[model samples]
Target: MTGKPKLYYFDGRGKMESIRWLFAAAGIEFEEEFLETREQYEKLLQDGDLLFQQVPMVEIDGMKMVQSRAILSYIAGKHNLYGKDLKERALIDMYVEGTTDLMTLIIMYPFSSAEDKEKKRAVIIQKATNRYFPVYEKILKDHGQDFLVGNQFSWADVHLLEAILMVEEKKSDVLSEFPHLQAFKARISNIPTVKTFLEPGSQRKPVPDDKYVKTVKRVLQMSF
Candidate 1:
């Protein structure tokens, strides 16, 4: 019998959720540990005696891996989820990197005030929407592929879909303005694997509660 995968994650809408969705879509049985507070995470670390100093670590048959993107790529390769060919795989990686860059900016907007965030959002739009969008639009147009890769689903598509959702949530109608990206997101979201993984009741959005936000706010206040 094969050993199950063990995954550690925080409760929030972030990188870890993407990996969780992948595992769920792949029909892989594994342990998911969701920590909502620093105290809970510390206790879990003590109890498990884990080696890593971060959440979203994965232990595959006792071999531990960290870094969300690295974990996603590793599992994608192992599970044949990187599309049909080497070129397709490269394209998948390309989009994954692109999405990561955008998401990094999007997440920061929420922790900041509206004035600062609006300025940042404008810059992101000028660079990401104008420059990056064209690059992605050309890729989707040339690839003639439903997914970011060849004719199949890949981690890249999932990451891109997540990025699109986040951008929408942050009040950017970049997708509507760019039809190709909109198409890409819609196509990826409808994948049989993705659909099954996202089935109702399988998982819940893990946005942090007000108390957790307040704690972080207090800590930042002290630091600054």
Candidate 2:
């Protein structure tokens, strides 16, 4: 594999930023391809591998990688960025999966009508607050530390912590209800590597809502 991979991303804040942060934290060298329009994005898609044909995909050693989480996992594993050991890796996976679930909801909200979006966001937040909070609390309690896993940092911590920041932008004090999670998010944010990555002008816009038909409201109905 090449020392530096080719990274495809958009220019606004969205799902891809976490991957960008992941690579930056790992100290990986990568060339970023930024697209600003449909034509440019489509042109690259035509040449991208057929499996997913998606951006935020990483091209490493001439191999086309797709799916955001998959790309994060691959990079984390390759760079020894997962965790300290098997147990820690498992914890990281748990946090990553939960964060993914939360992000998926956020991605769907912006595409719906304002009414539907408001309603959907409320439902998502309610469920997450009631059902998901305790689970995460237990995780923090189990770990007995600020990190989701071992002493060192991992992809999960970066992903969840960043997601919390994004969510809080739209929903104030979302993590306040869960003190452990609140502390956890703050702890990850304080890391020098993560702190730098979270700084301004580093994120790519999320996949456009117009591109995906069946608006956010539709997804919310099915999701919640």
Q: Candidate 1 has which clashing residue pairs, if any? A: none
> Candidate 1's error at 170, in angstroms?
1.7
Q: Which residues of candidate 2, in runs, are more than 4 Å off?
A: 1-3, 48-50, 203-224
* Model 1 ranges off by over 4 Å: 1-4, 37-40, 43-52, 84-86, 197-199, 204-224
- Candidate 1 lDDT over 1-224, as tens digits, reads 25888776644555576777677666676676655456765665776644565556788856677778788888888888887778878878887888788877765555656568688878667767776667778878887777667667778777777767766665657676778888887777677767766568666354444554455445224241
Q: Candidate 2: minimum summed lDDT over ten consecutive residues — where?
A: 213-222
Top TM-score hit: 2
Model 1 accuracy (lDDT, Cα): 0.69
Structural similarity to truth (TM-score) of each candidate: 0.79, 0.79
lDDT of 2 by residue, 180-222 (tens): 8888877877787666666775443344455433332232233
Q: Residue 72 of candidate 1: its Cα lDDT?
A: 87
Compared with the true structure, model 1 gives a TM-score of 0.79
Worst 10 residues of 1 by lDDT: 215-224
